[model samples]
Target: MIRTGNEYREGLKDGREIWMDGEKVTDVTTHPAFKPIVDVRARMYDMQHDPAYKERMTYRDNNKTNPVLYKLPHEQKDWADKLEAVDAVMNDIGGVVTRVGDETIGEMWSLCDGRDVLASIDDRFSDNIDRHIQAVTDNDIFHVSANTDPKGDRSLSPRDRDPDMMVHVTRETDAGIVIRGAKFETAAAYADQAFLKPTVGAWADEELSDYAVGCIVKMGAPGVKHICRSGFAGKSRAADYPLSNKFDEVEALVVFDDVLIPWEDVFFYRHTKAAQYVRSSLHRYSAFPYVLRLLYVADMMIGTALWNARQTGLDKLQAVREKIADLVCYREGINAHLTASIAAAQRSPGGLLMPHQSMLYAGRVFAVSQLQNMMHIARELCGGQICITPNADSFEADGSGEWLNKFYSLNQRWQADDRRKLLAFARDLLNSDYAGHRLTFVQFAQAPHFSHLAAVYQSFDFEGPLDFVRKSAGLSDQVKG
Candidate 1:
């Protein structure tokens, strides 16, 4: 059931309502803003079919070849396989893409691990999650997640103001539950289905609130509309913003105007305990791939800085070497965390292998929190030339071409055209508008920084440190409570 790139593109032509730049988009696959990233996604699907990558990208299950990324993890090799598969993809695509199925698929896997709690609320809910997980593998659906809602007037309670501020069930039909509100999700416009859930909050406070619901939302469903943010692509010249044009994954504010979620698709409904359980364990398995994306980001930074240093002959300077070392440290820091997390992988409640929680969550915190500083260090190493350089047009123009060539050609080997391309690449990576947006994107990709710290707190065993201190200080059982 592996899909081809063209098949994946055809799936986006199902009359989904998508708006960008104040106009309705007729075809997401052809639209300039979405197509590049969509093509990236489609390329990933096609890679699974290519013979050279077929072995690396897929595995045989029940006499069918399934995507390696979507397979349920059973042991450490499963994680290793995922790592290798993703590595193959990153190398193939030449960039990092966060929401292209693999990263978000694990969110449902998190719910898979929480089936007991879901079954306590409704046995059908647990069964739904298991089926959806398999469906993504069998059908090769491009799945994403919806968690955060556009909570307006947070000072007032949901009932006090507009209840629609949070996505809530407005009414129930024999067919399904009708939902109304909006969620801020990336890649929702081009994705096949989203595993929608309640936003993170005090789920313990309300037992049967309409807001406590989880379900599968088809992207092309009748009342679903995608009002997307203006993309990083199409606005800038491709040469000036290469990554922006090629790798910008457009995010959208998906409006659910009385959208229907069929009965079989609903995971939980009016169940606060289920919501609470899911909120706590939501990113358990997904955080690995999410954080793993940043490791690649770190490599990009290191690669950019190292190349810039070598091109400018700054590598010989002691200060320049120290800065490059700093970038290397950041890259290796992310790598070490990922490698160790896999090495110390744990088993989830539902018999899935999960990266060690402490290491994975801690790695997420370190990677996300330090991303901006690392970018700045890279910017400094690439030198002020990244900003002061003229556009590609100037280098290729008549009079300026001669002048730029004279100044830019540093040696017989390092010429004007190569230098311009390097600067443009570095600018787009570390200094362009796209660069800033990507930095912000990584900061809040899975959740927020506060949520990351909370995960670290919850996952880390405080008792172990407490035991050590208690034994060292001879402080006793009285303080244990």
Candidate 2:
């Protein structure tokens, strides 16, 4: 039942309404702007089928009625194994852009009923969770999540927004609920089945009932429309270069036009107090996945930056080595945290595996805080070489071809064109508009992350440590008079 890459590509050709720049995309898979994105996703699908990666990336499970899993496991090891597969594929591609690899997206949606983190909230969603897993094991569908709704103003609540600004449930019926408004900055929607959640938490007084309304619909369902974002890599002629080709410039705003979500699909409804818990749960499960991802990105950046430094002969300087050292620390710290989280994973009563919330949050907080430093260190170390490197087109151009090649080259071992390509990629990572957007994303996801750490600390009994301190100080455990 393992689908071929072409089968996956053909699967996406199904009718969907996506709008970009005042025009409706007739076909998502065939559109010029979207074709490359599809091609990239297809490559991920191909990876699952590739003889080398097939065993790791795809799996077969007894839970699966159909044997779609390339490598099947009935237990949590299957989940972890699949995660490893996702990490390997993502690492191989440069993690920053391939944020929603086919496997990553598929796995993201694989737990719609909150089996991952929402397991504690309600046992009812477990069936929903199993259904999704079985279908994924059967169809091998791709999915992406939309966690951020366009708040319009951070200071205001969802209800305070022009109702159309935030994705909110508008009406409730016995059959299903209708959602209005839009989700912003969604990654790779064109290639996805549906966005998972625009979160039912952070509710305003009026938006309370709307909060529990999370569900999935086919892309281009009755009211769904995709609004495209400008991309840094796809438009540039230098996109043919190594990193750019794999980079994800595919993003869109998901505007819901009174979309109907069935009751069966709704996981959490109006549990205002549990809102934070639900959001926290999603982050809990996601922490390692992203850490697994960032570690890969850091590796790519370090290697690419180092190569650029050496190619330009700037690697000889003590200061440059120091910068490289700092970058390496960033990479190492995240990996260490990733390892810690895995070692600390907890088991649920129902036999589901759950990651340690405290460690997971800590790992993400570390990643979010240090990513800027990693990028800055790379930029400062690389110096003007990153920005000044001529575009790939310039190397192939008749006008300045000879001048660029001669001037950009350093030693005979590295060609000028080769150096240009490396520097160009570094430049895109550091200086481009999309690069800034990515940084902003990291900042947002990281901000207030420490709150969860504090919550975990508060929830756990530290009386053992307190008793130790008291005993060491010879203080009495007796009550005060």
Candidate that would win on TM-score: 1
Candidate 1 local lDDT, residue 17: 95
Mind giving the per-residue lDDT tens digits that candidate 1 earns over 1-481?
Answer: 8899999999888999999989999999988898899999999999999988999999999999999999898888888899999999999999888899999998899998998988888788789999988899999999999878989888888778688889999899999899999999999999999989989788767669999999999999999999999998888788877899999988899999999999899999898888887788888889889888988888888888888888888889999889888888887888888889889988888888889899989999989999899999999999899999998888889999899999998898889888888888889999888889888988887888898999999999888889889888999768882
- CA lDDT of every candidate: 0.89, 0.62
Tens digits of per-residue lDDT, candidate 2, 182-208, equal 765444455445535545345444434
- For model 2, the stretches where C-alpha displacement exceeds 4 angstroms are 63-80, 91-98, 101-126, 153-161, 195-208, 239-245, 314-316, 445-465, 473-481
Q: Candidate 2, clashing residue pairs?
A: 59-69, 59-70, 59-71, 60-69, 60-71, 60-72, 212-268, 212-269
**Could you give the C-alpha RMSD of every candidate to the true structure, in order shown?**
1.1, 4.1
Model 1's number of clashes is 0
Best by lDDT: 1
Worst 10 residues of 2 by lDDT: 65-74
> Each model's TM-score?
0.98, 0.84
Give the lDDT of residue 367 in candidate 1: 90
